[model samples]
Target: MTTDLEFVDTQVHYWQPSANDWYPTLRSRPALYRDILPGDFPPVAGHVHVSAVTAPRAFLDETRWLDRMRHDTGLPTAIVGTIDPAASFEMIEADLLAQAESPAFRGIRVFSGLDPAADTTLELFRLLAEHDWIFDLIARLADVASYLPVIEKSPGTTFVLEHAGWPDGEEPGQFRQWREGIARLAAFENIDCKISGLGMALGTMDPQRLRPWVETCLELFGVDRCFFGSNFPVDSVAGTYAELITAYREITAPLSEGDRHKVFAANARRRYRLPG
Candidate 1:
């Protein structure tokens, strides 16, 4: 089973405590309260540097910084910058365009500052599609259904669901609710889900326990629409990099070599338009 499925992680974050912003959440978490950069990442063939929280004014700056980091390291081959979608429409537009100026800029991930149901949010989603940028949504399980209309309206925009809708835990009720929400999202052809970051739900990384959730996502989205993401540093609390990769490989081993390759690498490279 050692066929060539070059690893291209779709979710990795490069960050450090800046003078004005320390990524408060990371600072609070013992395992992630430090600097992480391309050098810190495992030797994957490529990766997409998802945005780490930055000060409101620093959004475009962080994008520039990431572009420079990619230039120097030849790593994080794709970059998903951040934008303050809560800002005025003009501001968000300016922020998105400024971020887009970076050669590697691919899209954005918002931890907050988005109300997909709002008029402004809907407009922003449309803008993403116009520019061919990604909306790496980070929604909680309870809020999944709320974004359906926005997603439905923005047909061309690629909406990537983060962390399997950020499952709170794997309790029976929780799993059912999350599964239902994901099923609804999968109905839209433009939506894709990341089968990463479930470690937070389990408290520890156990492939056996995570199998059902991983299988469910593939069953819903199909391998073509899904991507492999390590969610490093954050998932570091639950398991080592090697263990996480091994776990995913084992969980998806039943698929044919081409299908497994789609989940582990091809899908992301094609979705993100990453150059080799």
Candidate 2:
């Protein structure tokens, strides 16, 4: 690939699941039963070079591990550490401010458990906006609808929807739900979508099979708002890192080079404020 075609794997997890407190829950899923390190996913040896990665929140103290990965591998350009939205505003603000002090820190991620219309959740959005941090949302398909109000309320916050809302295109009524939910969420200008982690649900790395979902995401959010990600190790449960990347490439082969660049790298860099 040309230098300009270098990829930015937006979502990857480098952590020891066994040592994590959520090990019991994670281990139940065979794919996440072991330690996954930088060595596990070396630069693809020519096909695609992972120039940078944006790792989402992990099970334990994710920032400590993420900083370790950056120090160790010299990749993982930024990390979205976990946050306890339920904590007091004073506590959360102090913690987020301290975390922002790290060069590796770009934002904080929270599961979509908060009601979008709730006063408390709106306050959390304001807190993130105040810090100029991104809000990485790990939400299930059903949770997308609830986030619309939050997106509407926090117009200044850049909210990224992980895994394209975890759609299972093969399941009956699954795509329909994803289609409607995603379309609604995509309507919000502040929202962006990451095309990652689908292997965990799609069960195959066949680009042909994933084309519809991937294309729909692009069509709904457009090239500027859509970005590609490997969702590594976790996606490994269904396919290899190379396989997922190849699938993404194949699914996007028909697009114009400029559009492909946006999905493959540019969008992530711009959205996450990654260093050039």
Candidate 3:
């Protein structure tokens, strides 16, 4: 790694349990069906594990598992837990309180199918703001623009878009739509882009080919609002973990050392409130 190396990988998943127990949907993606623990990654100063499965009862349990891992193994300096936006507020609050007990708990990430403009969603944003916890937003690229209204209204909430807004692909039409939606979301000072998980849909792992997407994000969100998240074993579909890091390093090489540092580690430290 170069000087000011970003040792904090903001997005890493420790895949545990069998496909049936951890995430049944993962069975379709054999690369991610197996266990991917912290030991699997290259050495890093810190890691943040986003929730993969968000079943209500299992949600807090998963954070607890991660907390235990951090204490025992000493990676993932922080944890971004999960919440079921669809669940009743009382139940969600209980789970959140339980999760907050862990010092590593930073916030929760809710997945797609959320109505960006729905009252429920707005209320969820407010709930997160009350805790000053990070709100990890996941939406389909096609539907990304639909979220503009709600995010605009919830200025107090800290929003982090997951997987480049989950672009389904980079074809002309999809690329145009993804870029437009991402630009729109980037307009909000409250939001940050988690530059992770793109390998799931993208075909090649070459840094030059991938540079366009990464550059587009840097251009739109600026380096301060963008950070590296390997998305680990899941994103290994794009390339091996080492290859993914190499590609990011290659793509971001043009940045100044400080800006480069922010993309790799510093920004996540600020956004997730991780200690130095």
Candidate 4:
């Protein structure tokens, strides 16, 4: 099954003792407490890490910690660091510029799911544009309407919508909302979507159950605008690493080999500016 197709798991996270208090369940399990180092990943060419949603105020500290861990353990091909969109544009821009010095710092993430209508988010988008940093927008499907105005305002910034806009469960109306919202968001050239985190968002242990949302994301974002991600640790709650990748493969099988490669690696490389 070995083709020349190298993979880069673009959406995993590594946790530390500082994150323990936020996720008490994860802290209780020593087996799960181990940091997701490079060795824990499948034999891939590289990986990119998205910051976990703990300690929102300490984003810079988290980035420093992750950078140290990446240097010490050789984990993560790159990082999507967190920024509170509520911060002033000057502060956010300064923080982003500082993080850009780190080789592992690839982009910035703002969890739109937390506060759908946070007014400061528009400023955050402007900061992303000023620094030429990618913005990982984490919003619930229902929140997509709230983000549309901001997305429209920041046309120059590259936006990666996480979890297919974090679609709701299998309810027909919820699904329709997600589908329509994504199509609307897709109209913005700056926006792309990652086909990850569905299992976690759906709270399902079965990856097969995520087929509909995954299919819808591909249909909306298309291969060029979409990329695959493991969303590990978070996704580990739903299924194992192998299971996650296998599920992605099963869902993307209808696409051509080149398109699959884009989803698996090329799109991520381009999005994060990873070296080939």
Best-performing candidate as measured by lDDT: 1
Q: What would the per-residue lDDT of candidate 4 be over residues 168-269, giving only the tens digit for each residue? A: 777889788888888888888888888888767787746568888877887877778888787777777777777777767777788899998998899989
lDDT of 1 by residue, 1-276 (tens): 132557888989888774436366666676676778888876887888888875556767777777777778887798888777668989889988898888888898887767777899888888989999998988777787788888888999998988877777778998898888899988999988887888866766788988888999999999899978888878887888888888888898899999988888888888888986
Lowest summed lDDT window (length 10), candidate 2 = 45-54
Q: What is the lDDT of residue 67 in candidate 2?
A: 65
Q: Please state the error at residue 131 of candidate 3 in Å.
A: 1.1
Summarize candidate 3's per-residue lDDT along 210-257 as a digit string, tens digits. Answer: 787889889999988998887877776667877787888889888998
The whole-model C-alpha lDDT of candidate 3 against the native structure comes to 0.80
What TM-score does candidate 4 get on C-alpha atoms? 0.86
Q: Distance from true position, residue 16, model 4, in Å? A: 2.1
What TM-scores do the predictions have?
Answer: 0.95, 0.86, 0.93, 0.86
Better of 2 and 3 by lDDT: 3
Tell me how many clashing residue pairs each candidate has: 0, 0, 0, 0
Q: Is candidate 1 or candidate 3 better by TM-score?
A: 1
Stretches > 4 Å off in candidate 4: 1-5, 18-34, 112-119, 205-207
Winner by lDDT between candidate 4 and candidate 1: 1
Clashing pairs in 4: none
